[model samples]
Target: MWTDVTLKQILLITDGCSNVGTDPVYVAQTAREQGVTVSVIGILDDGALGEQGQREAENIAQAGGGMCRIVRTIDLSHTMQMVTQRTMQLTLQQVVNKELRQIMGEDSDALPPDVRTKVARMVESGTEEVDLQVALVVDVSASMTSKMPSVREAIRDLEFGLLARGGTHRLVVVTYPGPSGEDAQVLRFEGTSVADAVGALRAAGNTPTGPALFLAVRALRDLGESPATSSVRANPEDREEGRMRHYVV
Candidate 1:
């Protein structure tokens, strides 16, 4: 039931390797489904698209449905540093777009159709350049353990989906237990990298929603607050309690 009104503007930094345009495209498309934007930025600049890496950057940008800018850092050391710093900064900005009232707050009755879609798309177009964070919160109680593997499979598919898209789409996963006797433990913590996050989601626990919700919030908060933090967190101010629930068999 957790509905995210905030959308992220991603900045995809790339080296035009095996994944290249694929990652950005995947993020843009998937994020658009849930409201996120993606943009591309070429750093190492090694691709067949253009001279001096201009063409590669442009293609990456276009593929992500955003404007692409190429930066020329001195060498590997500087480039890595710049990429890390820039990615975090861009991720922060994306977080903002999701929750910011820059365009219009939740109170607005309705937005013009085309305009609303455009605004949403712009936010999603930047999914590639930044470090992508996808948090999957599942409900798993004793009654649900029989189906945990299916749920896990679904999430695993999501991971593959993000990886197939490439870039730094980090996945953070958690599961809430039902009220039955056995369900009451942390499935995953926020800010845990994709691999570790997935590893933590073992199937057995009660759905302690109150703590589970907060756990998810704390996980992301640990990663460093982002603009999307307000909209994405477990705040009564930003989200209604029912906005984060999901049922699976």
Candidate 2:
């Protein structure tokens, strides 16, 4: 069984549109139903993706309840970092709104916009010290071959960006169509950089993104059960004093 965690996301980076079995949007919707967010980054370089591809990217994100953005290869790293931070911010906002509804009455939706913003800011500041686990699911289909270099640089930049935020995080890299066709391979680097693994990916085979996402979710669930992550509580309680503070960001 999969363990419930504070945040579980599948960041899909692809260049071409899906041409496989199940629709990617449906897969993304299933992920959301299972408490996982799926964000898509469509890489557009030299006019690789057309109108249909862009629409598919947007539709997938909408179905998954996450953000989608299209960017050139040169901007991949910056966009990747932005997407991660944006997802965290949006999640924080949702947590704050839920807490507000619980603290205030159900009819307290009458609060002014500025007041709500202030409260959200307070909540974000309070939860800045929390840790995060991100699953990066990259599409290594044949079409994305030319964008591999940019993808590698992006992952490296994302790591530095996360570090600058002063939060502890574990980033697991999952690539689709591993040596064998349509297989999702989970790669981990000990005493080495994940960017290397990403850069080494060879683009081949079909884009079985639906199955890849299923694999990513499973990986995240397994990560949640690890001994290191097991000790961290999303909503911690003061056992001695019988007080509790619910924090989810």
Candidate 3:
């Protein structure tokens, strides 16, 4: 795995409950163990997500070392972008703290928390160049059909937001219980945009969230194990710096 990557995240977007396959919360814990941060967004339109669903979402996020939120379909895009940016900021702070320890040694503790935070943000802005890899996991269960259009729009917004931030990124889309009954359909875009691919998503079938997560984790791990990643990690210059990897569903 790419243990040296700066950040890893899994964003799960769903509207209803998980009724099939392995326990998603347990899978989230496993993902966290493997250095993947799992965050969840529960869409509450039409009152589809009940108390149980909310609890599950919260539990999964907690177990995966991330945050969980319940929001309307209309707010999905903004919420998703906020979560991504916040996670990245925190990861950067972690890297900054590590560097402080190396530089200040025992004297690092003398720095105030607010001062450290300010310096971390400044350092991250100037020095942290990231190679961001994201896996978008979306729930395509029957209950999510009506929200597909909004979901598609939200994805486009997310893409644009990332572009505006100015970084190198690779975003892949994965839908649970994919078209052919596979655990999930992994879609990679070439020259086309993510919105175009999202517009083609048809919601149906069961929400095998656990299996879908497993597939995403595997894909991200494969990316970390790729030859390109190996070459980057092997370079002495790159070895001292960190990159970001994420799985967002």
Candidate 4:
């Protein structure tokens, strides 16, 4: 039910009770796996079990990969409200970062020469910015056949968004065909601007991610030494000194 809805921050409160095994941690992990940052509050002074409960709470927080605060309260209601408010504020901050990345596609040093050349005209004509060497590797096996349309739409939306930013981001797409007996075939995509890349992609293969990723890495490494890589370097000074920044995205 929660997958369809987007949440920024999720806070879970537990009254460090001895009976509460790892439920807090379990919920927090689930929330964060869906891109939610989780916070926890341990309610101390609940009863004779407060100390034990507190320790369990702290352990749960660590296990869940979140921060925890101990609350000493006469009335549990007020403590819960405070924790809720704090969680909301943290979640709001996450939303802001998401918006920033949506606008800029995470900052990179410079555009490679090849990428720069493609976007040079666009930039000269007033394009915003572009992401370099963006690869969308999809696992398209037989099981995913029914969901192809949704996957395609998601990819299309991403393509449009990247192009709309307008600098000179290049795209590479590859789909894996499933294993046949003991052999697998690989599909490789050429690096190009987002528009052409998406238009050329079709899903009719198995999901051989391991081999595909290896090829993608090799192709990216080869391109890293090209003029395109130089042009797209984050800073001209770095390039002048023969410095290259390799990014793994």
lDDT of each: 0.39, 0.72, 0.72, 0.40
Residue-level lDDT tens digits of model 3 in 1-249: 123344567788998777788898898999989988788999998845899999989998898787798999989999999887776666555555566667665232468786555465444552234556666789988888888888889888887766654345556677898887777878666555777777777778887888887887787787775633211222233322233111100
Per-residue lDDT tens digits of candidate 1, residues 19-40? 1113324434544444333344
After superposition, candidate 2 runs with Cα above 4 Å error: 1-5, 105-110, 228-249
lDDT of 4 by residue, 1-249 (tens): 111122233333333242312244454455456444444555444233266656756664565445567754333344434443344334433443354356566422244566434333322222122223433334344444444444445545544544454234444444444244211223344553333433443434332333443343344444445533212323223332221112111
* Residue 82 Cα positional deviation in candidate 4, in Å, after optimal superposition: 30
Q: Please provide TM-scores, in order, for all candidate models, with all chains considered together.
A: 0.37, 0.82, 0.79, 0.33
The TM-score obtained by model 4 is 0.33
After superposition, candidate 4 runs with Cα above 4 Å error:
1-131, 178-207, 225-249
**Candidate 1: stretches off by over 4 Å:** 1-121, 128-130, 177-205, 225-249
Give the lDDT of residue 81 in candidate 1. 32
Ranked by TM-score, the better of candidates 1 and 3 is 3
Ranked by TM-score, the better of candidates 1 and 2 is 2
The better-scoring model by TM-score among 2 and 3 is 2
lDDT per residue as tens, model 2, 139-223: 8888788788888889988877656543356678888777676567897675557898887788898777777777887887887
Clash pairs, candidate 3, are 9-247, 10-247, 11-248, 11-249, 12-249, 13-249, 137-248, 137-249
